[model samples]
Target: SRSKNSNKERNLIRAFTVLDAYASKLSMPENAKEHAAYIYRKAVSKDIIRGSSIPSMMAASVFAACKQLGIPRSMNDTAKVANMSKKKLSRTYKRLVKNLELNVSSFEADYVSKISNSLSVSEKTARLAGKIIHDLKKEHLHVGKNPIGITAASLYLSAINYDEHVSIEKISKKTNISTVTIRKMIKLLRPFASKYLKSIDLSV
Candidate 1:
């Protein structure tokens, strides 16, 4: 019985150590960090951690916490910080979500504000992006798209509409998306956003 208890402690330490490493890199809020640790414990109690490696489980926990907390960290960003491949991290994340049946908050239009702030975009552009995302969501245009890419696309279009002189490459860098993906996202979304941008004559 003592050894069993000791094993649980060691597992917790290993899990927290891995979580702390990635959380520090992301500068995650204390609440989100604690929630992740708590979720890790739940996973252990459910025996969902059996087949998966500890680091992968830790990565998934923190990633889920970010989603639950509505943090704007991308899967690529999570992959980078966790020192794991994106595919692997995503697979683990999906498993955790499935087993835990976690009810993550959906990304809101206001999430654009967080993304814009991280990229240092102007407030005006951020508002425009929010409007764009809100409008797009009205018709379910963003349903299957990657959140970071879609947000980046909206911000890029908003900047152009506001005559802010920002480039897709720049937005790509800020959001950690490839320029190609942002371009594709913009291509589809631009038509829908055109009517919105019409009100502002940025050319002036």
Candidate 2:
């Protein structure tokens, strides 16, 4: 069984390489990276990694681990960092979850920091955008909605009020969300903005 052991070792090395590279690229925390490595090993034990590309499987493992850990990284961000198409990454992620029976807990996302850092919005504006998200959660308006779209819309609203000059196209590019969806989310958010964030006039 020496040959089989050697092949397994090589696969482990390759998986580690992909995981490490993507983790570094995404700035994943130490705990998250370790958890991803563990998930990769579990997937290997389940024999689900055989048909898929190693990079895709490893990246999918990371994504699943992040979801389990409530990390704020989205599929779009992870796919971009892994240098793979979102569709491929998403498919691989779904396969991993189904085959491994991974428990990916649902959690509220903190997309303001991610989008703010990506688009270079001011810290003050990011805080205001966070407050917007908090307000939505309190009002239960964020349930059954796309969190990233809501966050993008909130950041856009806060940026304009603060005169930060970030555009919808840029947010769409960074978020992999459509401008149309962002605009729709903005419309839903405007009434709340008018109520809580009174400094900005939504009557435009």
Among all windows of ten consecutive residues in candidate 2, which has the lowest summed lDDT?
Answer: 195-204
> Which candidate has the top score in lDDT?
2
> Which digits, one per residue and each the tens of the lDDT, describe model 1 over residues 139-167?
99888678777888888888887777787
Q: Which window of 10 residues has the lowest lDDT sum in candidate 1?
A: 195-204
TM-scores of all models?
A: 0.59, 0.57
Whole-model lDDT values for every prediction: 0.81, 0.83
Cα RMSD, model 1: 6.5
Candidate 1, 123: how far from true, in Å? Answer: 21
Model 1: residue 130 alpha-carbon error in angstroms: 7.8
In angstroms, the error of model 2 at 48 is 0.3
Candidate 1 local lDDT, residue 77: 85
lDDT, model 1, position 66: 75
> What TM-score does prediction 1 earn?
0.59
